[model samples]
Target: MTESVQQLVRYTRIQEIVGDVIRLRASGVALGDIAEVENTDGEVSIARVIGLDRNIVSLQVFTGGKGLSTDATVRFLGRPLDVVYSPNILGRIFCGSGEPIDGGPLLTTDRHVPVGGPTVNPVMRVMPSRMIETRVPMIDLFNSLVESQKIPIFSVAGEPHNELLARIGFQADADVLVFGGMGLIFDDYHFFRKSFEEHGVFGRTIMFVNQASDPLVERLLIPDMALAVAERFAVEENKRVLVLLSDMTAYADAMKEIGVAQERIPAVRGYMGDLYTQLAQRYEKACDFKGAGSVTILTVTTMPGDDVTHPVPDNTGYITEGQFYLHGGVIDPFGSLSRLKQHVIGKETREDHSQVMNTMIRFYSEAVESERKQAMAFELSPFDKKLLKYSKLFRDRFMNIRVSLGVDEALDLCWKTLAECFEPKDLLMKQHLIDKYFPDIAEKETG
Candidate 1:
């Protein structure tokens, strides 16, 4: 029998209920198939099959399984969870269950697409060689987020990672923006929606939010829904889509909670053994489609207690291309890296881009060393004083997250900062770059 025929199968006996997970004996059930569990009281709850064991199947209720009795009827939908994808969804907000929460008109169901589908085939992927400028000096001049690259912002609790993410959402040069907030508090959710609206990007953005008070199973749906819509926009509409998912640690924790309810064997830190696989499945959805547009993923992975060794961040470090380390309210130049930056830096940007980037970082390293010497009360050399000056200028000009500048503009500012702190000879950059792009302070005074 076909899947549609299988949809007619229904069972009235629920064998077990553990937390939000319910198990029943069914023969024609498939994993990821949606089902309706109707209570004897005439209320129905939606659920999806999560596991199978020959004749037994486990389903996770989208609504908590509270007050659900053993006699609840299970009628399989024979299809996976789907989200609406159309121009009507633009500027709209959805909850984890893919329902509209923005008080907008209900979208037609004819345009719905299944979530959690397979990643794009390698044959359909194109090389990512373009840069997605965010106008943030640190990322534009230093890390250079590349199109179709999957990277994360490694942050800790109480940091402004969401603010940075929101800044990128409004400032990034992309055709569409998809924002997913997993386990966010009401205040953070309000901030994101308000930021996009105030910056005038809300009209081109789609949001999938799962608040902290929502059902645990629904938190798992946010990324899948956002990515499903983003993929359609990139492939069908041929638009460059940027996806931002914040606090993936909460997503992982939701998985762990479900795993514990299902009594699965635990891996390191009580997380499921498939944690890496789950994360890779989502991150790999980022791709530059051949002969079409691209989908770039930038996520926020919070490391608990500032510990990188935590399972969520540790597993994430292996899956993503690179990370932007956010610490002490700034993107740490020393810890942040973009492995694909070589594809665009100096090629898509100004020729002086690479030289200025390397020189600024080198001088900043020395300046940090100079800071240590000053702290120890050691005698400071004349050059150390210059390094200190350069350090302060660099922090104010480029390191501050709020400082925004175009790539070329930031490069010019780099040369100015260097010239003010040291002579042209002091900079080890190529003479050609210095001669061509370097400022002529002496000639200016003479003129």
Candidate 2:
């Protein structure tokens, strides 16, 4: 016997066709309702109900309106988009529409959960208390990545942000990794999967991919799909899930395109006025469920031409906790920040983590000034010469971007660098820390 498919009731009135958006006089249709548009050639495509004004509705065709005439048949599916949620979802890769494209069996026999719903209730959320060690010195040591934190890697085109995300997915201590690749090239998508599998983390990894050639509408769905699975993992399975969303600027571009198709008025930089709300709807999904595991989000937002004030990064900076600025092929220590790092830095990490972080950054900042003086050929003092040496050592040891060290290793390296650049009295750490952590300081004092 064959499985029966429910046939939806169809509508024939097509009022207007502008680009991929179709407008029609309709009733009993709700926003976000799934619709099917059939062209004159009997080819059908799936669309979403994006705009519903009184009785008239506007639908965005996912596959785009290519061959559809103004008289295309419209069928309201009476539902929004949903994904299959189960333990079987792990070790699987799906397209933006939640279809398994990895040559695997079709997903069945599980719950169908809606995507792009409201974020978790703030009352149910607890203060994030755990640290998610990415094992990257720029993050784990200096700026910690706390659980339930929503931060972005701010980079431009041609940067190694994808490499950074892959490293985190491979090394982060989270129980499950949910990755959403929006507008990625085929190579980047393949790299993520292959790297995860090679690093032996693919079993707990679920990927929702929207390639550059895929429909723009799909890009908007990738984040929601990934976050839905992360939520299920965190709340039900009690798993600490980390969601990695890359190239959110592409998602924003897709939203802008759809907004233009809907004839909506554009806001700042030609983006929709509600860009912040739209971004918050997805990013606010990062949460720590009470007594359960948390869902931490780390997304990549590529700035256009490295402009931070661009509308996408501008709105994103407001929504996300903080940003990791990826410039000069590295995570710039001066530019990147984790606002929630203070919550878990010393509490969850070592006894000297907070002090080491402060001392290293302060010294590195002074080193930068010393280097500028040297570049200007200014006569340098003895302290300025020491600052120059410390800065160069800091860049090579910590800021090299490829310098992958654990938090403990990074802290140890900080002391070694300080010992190389300064004497016992020159290091301004607490006396107890100096007595305990800085053996070289005591050795210098004895000598």
Candidates in order have lDDT scores of 0.93, 0.87
TM-score of candidate 2 versus the correct structure, residues matched by position: 0.94
What are the per-residue Cα lDDT tens digits for candidate 1 across 1-447? Answer: 886666666765799999899998987777888999999998999998889988889999999889999988988877789999899888999999999999988886548899998999999999889999999999999999999999999999988999999999999999999999999999999999999999999999999999999988889989999999999999999999999999899999999999998899999999999999999999999999998899999999999899999999999999999899999999999889899999999899999899899999999999999999999999999999999999999999998889889898898888888878888898998999999987789843342
RMSD of each: 1.8, 2.9
State residue 110's C-alpha deviation in candidate 2, in Å. Answer: 2.9
The estimated TM-scores of all candidates read 0.97, 0.94
Ten contiguous residues with the weakest lDDT in model 2 = 1-10
**lDDT for predicted candidate 2 compared with the true structure:** 0.87
Evaluated with lDDT, which candidate comes out highest? 1
Q: What is the lDDT of residue 77 in candidate 2?
A: 73
In every candidate, how many clashes are there?
0, 0
lDDT of 2 by residue, 1-447 (tens): 222223344476688988888899887777877888888888988888889889889988888877679877887776788888998988999998788989998878778898878888889899988899888888888778999999999999999999999999899998999999999899999999999999999999999999998888888889989998899899999999999999889999999999998889999988999999999998999999997889999999999988999999998999988999989987898899899998998788889998888988888888888888889999999999888888888878877666778888888878778877886578787888876777565654453
Can you tell me which runs of candidate 1 are displaced by over 4 Å?
1-3, 6-8, 442-447
Clashing pairs in 1: none
